[model samples]
Each structure stands twice: as C-alpha cells, then as structure tokens.
Target: MDMWLHTANGQVNLRVSRQLYTVQSEYQTIEIFESPEYGRLLVLDGDVIFSRSDEFIYNEMVVHVPMAVHPHVKKVLIIGGGDGGVARELTAYADIEEIHIVEPDQVFVEACKTYFPETAQSFDDPRVQLIHRDGLRYLRGRQGEYDLIISDSTDPFGHTAGLFTKEFYGSCYRALREDGILVYQHGSPFFDEDETAFRSMHRKVYHSFPISRVYQAHIPTCPSGYWMFGFASKQYHPVTDCNPQRWQARNIKTWYYTTNLHRGAFMLPKYVEDLLKEAEAK
Candidate 1:
C-alpha cells in the first residue's frame, strides 16, 4: 500500500517495503516506514522526522556547524534528539568528554534503537548519558555546565511549543559556559506556518543571545526542501571566528557538511534575510 505523509507544504507518497514499527509514545505517535526512495523513514505525528537518504544533511548541519566554530567544545547537551542521530554525530568527537541527551519520549528512543540501529549506534557509547525528562526542566539548576547545547527538537507546536520560548532560550543561555554555542532547528521558511514560527522563534532567540544567526539546509523530505536552523552564541561568532582549517584537521569524514558550505549556508536569501530583519525590528 502507498502511504501518504502530510507535512506543511503538502503530502508525500511513500512506497512501504514494510512497516518496521509503530508506537504511541507518551508525547506523540511514532512510526517507521521503509521506502525505496527514502530508505528507512521516521514519522512523528504525521510529520517526516528523518529519512536515511537525506538524514545526514539535517544531522550534520545541526551538529558540525556549531562544533566547527567552537572546536574546544567538551560537555554537550542535546535537547529532544530521541532518534539518536545527533548523539551519534557528537560521539564521533573524542574531545567531547560527556554528552547528555534530554528526550521526553522513551518509545521513540526504543523504536530508533530497534529499527535504525546504525543511526542509534551512539546510544551504546559510554560517553552519552540519556535522560528521559523535559528539556526545559532539566536546564533549571544547570549553570555554566556545557560548552554547546543543541535543541534537536520537533516543530514548535503542542508539547514542543515551550521549547521555542524566550524563557527556554534564556535557560539555554544560562546552561552554557561563557563561550558556549547553541544550535536548533527552526523549521522551513518556505511555508507560511513555518515562517511565522521562525519569526517568533527568531525574535525570542535574538533577545536571548548576544550573537544570533539563521542558517539554511535543503532537506528534500521536509516541508519545503528549505529548512532553517538558529545559531546563538555568547562569545564565539559562528562565521567570523569559524576556522575551517582547524575543523578539517580533525579529519572527521562528513557526507554533507564542508567548510565552504558552512559559510555559504549562512548566506540567506533576500526574503529570509528580510524576515529575520523584521523579527529583529519588532
């Protein structure tokens, strides 16, 4: 049977090789599908979370961009990356002493471990500490603990709405060290709903961090094929301070992320630039 996945842009048709797994987590519905085009596909509450074919694009961009600029990152906090892709990327860096993942859904974690084992390989890594709790609450008592914080959350809606708030961004700000960096998924600007969300999120993030910027990634399975991520830092600038040679020296092999592409990703289209400008003015 052909399965239709509904996103903000429209619906995507997937030819399922098999229904690998399905679970109703405490938070939302989680399903994994195998498609010829996308390979193993994960859908959360009807939205395409990640697919094997282009998963590297979203995962690499979110992790490496900030890590590249801030090479001294040691302690890391990942908010809402239940699929384990972000944790996998973080574990690759030996300098990273500890990685803490705060995810609300245990079902999502188990499902990913069961079906996407390759992507979930990092779950077994000794450096990762998986916590089943609310990300916002987890940051309450934390002060100057982590060098980098990545909010790999679902879209800003329902239970996830609080993740994008000024208060949450403020918490993230407080949770980071003096030279800490934060990167989060901001959704696609091509869709009206996503753009509106981006505006509100961008504004809150702008007010929270001293240096904030929006970067783009092209994920074909996502709503508009044009996704956005926010980078907010306390001291290190993502671009000006970005040392491509320093990162390349690590010899970390990446399929999607490159130093040149990192610079180009921040070059937003005029409309996106104007949207960010409007958010800043408001």
Candidate 2:
C-alpha cells in the first residue's frame, strides 16, 4: 500500500512510501518521509518544504540569481532556511567568506542534519554560522553589514507572517550594505490567495527598497509548481547588472539557474504584470 501526504489546502495528494523520521518541535511539526517519486521529503507543519528530486530547482534559483548580479558578495545572511539548502548553495562559492543563518527552530536543523545529509552538509562548512533565534529580531541591530540577505523562509502564515510585513522588510533594507541585494521566496503568483500575498509583499518591499522586482522559478512540489522570488537591490538590477561572463568565470555549474535564465526570469506574464500594476494602484 502507498502512503499519501496532502499539501497546502489539501488540494493535492503526494505519494509517500515509508516514514523516516518525525518530530513535533516547539514551533511546528517536522516530518521526513521517503517518497519513491521525490526521493527524500522534508515536511514542516504539514507542508512539503522540499523533495530531494526537485529541490535543486528551487534552491539554485533562489541563491544564484541575485548572487550572479552582484559583482562582489562577501558577507551573506540567510533567514529561516532551516533545511540548509540555501546555505549549502552560498557556501559553494569561495568568494563568500561568512554566512550567518538565523533560524528559530533548532529541531528543524537537527532533523535536516539527520535525514538529509547531502543538503545539511552546509553546516560542516567553516564559513557557515547557524544562530538559533527569530530572524526578525536577529536583524534588529545589524545595519549595513551583509552584502546579501536571503530570506529562505516558510510561507507567510502563523509565526512567519511577520516576515512579509513592511517592518521586516525595512529591517532587511537597513541590514544590507549600500550596494547589497535582498532575495527571498515570494510565494506563487498563479493562485488568487497566493497572488494577493505576492502583490502585498511586492508593495511592501518596494516601499523599503529603492529597486525591487519579482522573478519566477518552477518547483514541481510547491503549490502550483510555479514559484516566485523577489529581488530587491539598492544599486543593481537583476538583469542589467548581471555579469554572465563573471559568473561563468567562477565555474559554478547549476542544475536550474543559468545566466540566460536569470535574464529571462524577470519577464512576467500578463496577469502577473497586471497584478503588480494593481498593487501599485492601491
């Protein structure tokens, strides 16, 4: 018999085989399951955060796009990326000297370290610093410090909803250096509810940063399989400042992100374009 796990809204049922590990942390429920289709699966609060088979797509896009655009990114900060996938990608680059992660849940980190060793290996890097604290509060005093800040957080709900607020974005803006960039998971723009949140987030981030834009990535396991990421910068535009030659010189080979795709991701669909316009109107 096959096991099934329903994702957000319980609208889709993902097939599973054996339960590997389960933990009820103070923050949320974390589960690891072996799925024949997706390989190792990581679940938090009943939401499928990532499946090993396709995680490269989401993780690579989220990390590489902004990094490729920024000429020199040395200091990086990640908020709420408990799975360590984001940190794993950042550490792969030798140019990044320090990586500070502010994740509130230690249980989630241990769960990832135990079950998803490949992704969790990020913790082994000497450059990575994992801090157990709320990401919002962690950024309170750090101003003009990080060259890049990536919020690889959960969807906006429960305790994470604050991450989407104008106040949190303001903090992120202040935490970044003058030429630094901010990248984060901006939910999906395909559904009504998700699009509403996306538009609101874009509006709030726009107010905080001088330049901001939304980009797309395809994640088969996420809601609707079409995900969005936000790029906000004080000095660089995602496409204009992106140096394909410079990134290629680093010899970083990625599964989903390419310099060509980085240029193309910012091309929004009609509906998404209209949504941004509508948000601006309000």
Candidate 3:
C-alpha cells in the first residue's frame, strides 16, 4: 500500500519506492520507507512522523523560534523526537550544554540510529542524553531543571494520548527553569477533524502558561499542508523580548528558521487568531 495521510476532506498519498525497515516496537509500529518524493520517511503507528526532505522546516522552526527569543538556553529536554533530528539542530548552538531526548519505544529509537544515522547521529554527541522512558513520567519531579523543552511527540492518540492534557503541560511548565520555553507542533488549523482538538489543545496549553502563542509552518508530509506550533513561555515574550540580532550573531546555519522569520512566525492569520481568541475565552 502506498503511504498516505488522511485529511478532513480526503487523503494525501506519496509514491513509495520501498520499505527500508518495519518492526513492531513495544509501544507502536515502527516503519521506515523510501519514497521518491520525500526521501526517507519515518512512520509510527501508521502516522507520518517526519520525512527527510521537509524535516528541516519542522525541526528548525520548532527549535529556533524559542532559541532566538530566549537569550541563553543551556540545557534542553526533548520529549519524543528520538530520531535525533531535533537535537541535531540544537547542537548547532555552542551554548546548549545538555540535550535530553526521551522516547518510550526503544525499538523505534534503534531503528532511527540504523536507518537515519545522519539525523540520529546526534545521539552520539557528548551533550545529548537519550532517555528510554515516557516523557510525561520523565517530567515528573523535574523542577527548574531545563532552559527549554521541545515536545516533538506524535499526535495525541494511542501511544501519546496522555500528553495532550492540562496536567502534562503543567508538568512541562514546572520542569523548565525561569525564562524557559516550550515549543511543540499542535497540528493543522485547516483540517475539520483537527480544528476542534487544536483549539482544545491550545486552551490546555494556555491554562498552563502565562504566555502562550501559536505559529505556523508548511509541512508537506503532515496530515495537512498547514501546521501549527505552540510557543509557551514562563517569562519571555516571543516577539517583544526577542533578541534577533544576538541570535543572528551566533551564525547557526539553518534551512528554514532564521532570526528575521522568528517574528513573522508568531504573526498568525486572522482566522487562526480568531480561533486562539475563542480558545482563550472558553
């Protein structure tokens, strides 16, 4: 069967060349497929996690948006993203001291190391500590432990259903040091099925954080062409407190995320803004 993602109206399918790896991981079905359009694709529980070609767009925005605004980020906690692509982007900054990636399925992580070695190679870095455990559990008892936290998790269902609740975002808030930021892709605003859940998810995150904002990116492999990321912080305002010049000075090379685009990312469309307003009101 050709790899496909279901949309609100219909579905999108990619031309798959062959299967690279397929396994039944403890937590989910792990599969890697070679596609003519997107190159190597990672699928967990039949969901498109990331594709090599467009991963830079997703990884860069989710990492650098907070990295640019928050002046100094020394340690980071990444929930999911066992593929190591997320950590790979963070390692570009010399100031990042510790990068922790927690994945529930050890088998999926191993598959990334073998098939996506270039991205997964971040695990070999001295700074990254790959934790084989549930991220929600990992965040428990972690108070003021990290400068930043990135939830690179899959959509809320099956294996990750627990992550979308109010308690989990509160856990994320407590896990971060003062001035820390949390960024995670919250799904698309365009899809009919996702719009309600996205608003609710935004509401839950807003409840946990004093400053909660949503941003957009075009991720082709995702369920919809449009995707949103939540930017929640304890102190820093993603736009007002943002220090773009200081971040630009670091000269971290990136494909999609730039210091200039950081502000624009937070500039939501009118419809999206209305949704956020409605979410906040409810």
Q: What are the lDDT figures for the candidates, one per model?
A: 0.89, 0.89, 0.87
* Model 2, TM vs. native: 0.97
C-alpha TM-score for every candidate: 0.96, 0.97, 0.95
Residue-by-residue lDDT tens digits, candidate 1, 142-213: 899999999999988878878988889999999999999999998888756567877999999999999999
Best by TM-score: 2
Task: Give candidate 2 misplaced runs (Cα > 4 Å).
Answer: none
Ranking by TM-score, best first?
Answer: 2, 1, 3
Q: What total of clashing residue pairs does each candidate reach?
A: 0, 0, 0
* lDDT (Cα) of model 1: 0.89
State the TM-score for model 1: 0.96
lDDT of 3 by residue, 1-282 (tens): 674444234545677878888999779988888988899988777777788899889989888889888888999999998899999999999988999999888888888889998789898889999888988888888899999999998888888887888889999999999888999878888866678998999999988899999988888987767789999999998889888789889999987887667878888889899999999998
Error (Å) of candidate 1 at residue 91 is 1.4
**Span of 10 residues, lowest total lDDT, candidate 3:** 3-12
